[model samples]
Target: MLSNTIFNTIQKISFIKRTKFYNFCKEIIFPFIVTNISKLFKDDIDEKLIVMGAFGGGAFVDNSKYLFEFLNERSDYKLVWIAKLNHVAEVIRKKGYKVVSTYSLKAIKLLRSAKFIFMTHGHMDLLPIRFSPKTTKILTFHGTPIKRVDFNIKEAFMYNGWGDYFRLKLKNNQYIDYVLTHSGNKIEHDVLSKQLLISSKKILPLGYPRNDILLCKEKEFTEELKKKYNISEGIERIILYAPTFRSNLIVKFEISKQELNRLNKLLNELNSLFLIKGHMVSEKIDFNDQKSIKLLDKSADIQELLIISDLLITDYSSVQLDFLLTLKPVILFPYDYDEYYRTKGLNYDLEEIAGGPIVYTTEDLIDTIRNIDNIDYKFKEKRIMLRERFNKYVDDKSTERVLDFFNIKYRA
Candidate 1:
């Protein structure tokens, strides 16, 4: 695997350049087109709900796809999705929805005229999009309890580079409205915004419609996943090792050539196979020839993986919060806990928020695994507790709650 520091540096350069280029187009071409679209599409503004899945990857993919399925038969909202990615746009188009390629000044105008807009989620990149303050925006917050970055008097005085991002982008909570809840964490509703300095009345504790797939344990789906990996019918357990990206990037991930060697050896010895999955930003790992330990190459479908997965070992990927509905065992591997807490920050401390086991070292991880050797006994109680707490309703009809929140009546 390539070093994360080098990868992140390259990505940051590419990100900055991309942001500048897009913002320039937004400022120049978008206004002219949006103005015209408003006149041309005045007749259609109330006919369709234009949703910008501008985040344009797995996160938005999960939300948009599920919403599309729910609104498939409804004629109230035409339900147009704007996509920037070719592959994902193709996926959405395949589902019979018209996709505006993305960022055409004309398209922005059309989006502005829509009756409502779903801001897929929190994205700082949107700081540039020109739309009227009157546009109805729904910010679906996947994680609402995100810990705020508190600047110290001393740190602010130093004028550090690390403080600059928080200084400019965050400093306030007035950017978004209407917190769409996935886990239904009521604690977020009571907490007041620091920047807004007033209570937000738009926090809706509705369940995410996308995660409905996780609740389904169909024999056909489970069998297909096992067959895909050539895992025999029921020989061993399926453990998912999904880790989020480390903001610090370097210290959070200490790749010991020795540890990789040890992990390869341990995989050969272990009974339950571990599928190593990197976060969206994490550098991909390539294993020479290992069956028990494998790395995900380019499979976009995570819902299927979640279905076959029996025990999940994740680190703050929000998938931990997503998978909480199933009551699966999640193990947090915060090797860079101090660095992450100091820098990236968490909405809630893992000790309080994470409803599962946490391991800080290799030996401790192994010991935790042994202690929970019996799959049925290990997570039975915790899973049930998580299920009732996180999920208000775990059924095919979670779309109902989402529609109730949006006031979009479900037709089918």
Candidate 2:
């Protein structure tokens, strides 16, 4: 237990001193307790399963979405989903799935008892519980990472996570057994291993289960979405511009109001609806007056949007890789490319491997969108090569592959 004297001393000290004291407690004292407690209750634990996402706050999106759909119906193992918010728990409960708050007594018992724990993000709340030797941990990464991530820091001021660059080196590798990888290449694997300090052998090349929905021919789902969005037949082309968040960004977009108007006009002329899907960190954007341009709600299913979209416009987002499965056209809008590269380093040169025209200016973006019909055909061969390099399986069997590898059978 932390002493009151430590708190008093922390209060008396400078900000730098306080930070050091907190780190000492967190990195040293806290882990020691968790490690012992985990071992003490190891024998009492059950052979159950637990799945979480985005620190147990959000819905079962990303890889967990596919896994949940498959596992929810099965009667194999004792399953429990840890959601941080009551609303999220309610959503899961409405579907007849067992759910609990992350801090609930049930969750605490389940965390200790679950033989296998699958998560999109690290379970920071449950600390020092080592993987492999105790519980089998599987990390179904939320998205394909195109940016410098994990403990890989390029700039000092840009990073806002725990510990200094040096201290965070191997910190992320703690209590994790298997890491799901998207790229099938050896070089990319090596890069990822170095970045995350994970072993190459532990990296599973099971293509993202999330992408399975992309391959599914959900005509009904598409039609329903079309009706909801007022997208009629013969003019059903949808252009989705989903951009990545720049941390602590002062300026959002490089385009002017007039440029957006021009973009909207072009979309209207082409019988397309331009949708803007902002990042979670992005501030509230309103294009209500612009009829052709619409900002998707925060909770909108991106997969559904992707399915209906004829073209995608993005800058340094791994969503581009998922879009590759559709073999659709992507327009690169790297307006702040240099600033982004300097602040947060990219894993790949977006301009080089983009497989489509890279537009820097707003005028260029309008031009690219105007000729999207021809542009889609231009990058077919390049997209094919990119897919082969990144995706191990282009088929919809990725979810099945993951299940089979873990010996998790589907519901009869």
Candidate 3:
């Protein structure tokens, strides 16, 4: 098995630059060996067994986390979480949930025998091996699409030539049995199907399980976060600054130390706590010793953060769409719009979908934060409009819908 560092380094190399032998081993040789070996096991899939993981098994978060929580409370199925890291496994085990190491023999057996396998990203959620054909593979993708994804992106590393593209399409279509989407709109469903290289019938517009918590436990989570973070007394608001990951560029604070200090002072005056939650793949920013600013743990669930936040600040992230559910003000900070657009193309025009003020400068961001109340009032209708376009169901029954769609029985 390749270490993550070497694997990531190899992935960063342009596909065309990689040797033919490397590409053959990766795209063809590997899958053939895994598939034939998996067939030899002949493990009968257990009808009630369900296995799930997210963020390459390094985090217990995203659609998988919420759905796992829902199923964990019931006594209908055998639930297992695949954890790549020992600490992650320990954390979930401490909570009395079943967790298996990604490389464990037990985990391999589970993957071979699970009736249903749920993942947020791809094979990385569990072991990157071909599973039994009887296993139902479901991808509860982490976010709604705003940026181009999978085959839709022209510069994606998976495609070196037409042959690589066709092979990937075949592999994806074979592995992914179903994909969950938030909106019921056919346009969105079709777009997702094409991007994922799967049949349109495979797309399930059953809403996102992650959004269920946003609707069901807003107050509970808000209070929990305030206490957990030791929020200062008299703090009136919580502002979440969540930026999307960039493939070709780093996400930086951009503002100088003096400007950041000034922004911190302004936040203090507003009695607000500003939380910075960068994407998992993004560069980390330090906010230690800043009274008003806090850099959230990278592993912290963004949905939980969204529920606790009074307002959101972001740039081209699907998080802004999720924040629309809160009906709170959102401020877009597209500081590198041109560069980002050039590298990672957007699926939609940023201006068309922006539900709030779009600020390109630190000064503008600060100004917008200072006048957030006015921004909130002015953007309420826009947020509602965008929400309708994106989310089909606003209720806390998405998890229920998913189970019903799959005909999985559970306790009421």
Clashing pairs in 3: none
Order candidates by lDDT, high to low: 3, 2, 1
Best by lDDT: 3
- lDDT string, candidate 2, 283-313, tens digits: 5666777788777765566777888898899
Model 3: CA > 4 A from native: 1-33, 151-170, 217-221, 248-250, 281-284
Clashing pairs in 1: 30-105, 34-109, 146-347, 147-346, 147-347
The 0-to-1 C-alpha lDDT of every candidate, in the order given, reads 0.57, 0.70, 0.79
Summarize candidate 3's per-residue lDDT along 19-53 as a digit string, tens digits. 77685565555545544555556579899999999
Instruction: Name the candidate that leads on TM-score.
Output: 3
Q: Give all TM-scores, in the order shown.
A: 0.74, 0.83, 0.88
Cα error of candidate 2 at position 407, Å = 1.0
Model 1 bad stretches (over 4 Å): 1-44, 54-60, 73-76, 123-135, 144-177, 183-185, 191-199, 225-235, 248-258, 268-271, 374-383, 394-396
Give the lDDT of residue 52 in candidate 1. 48
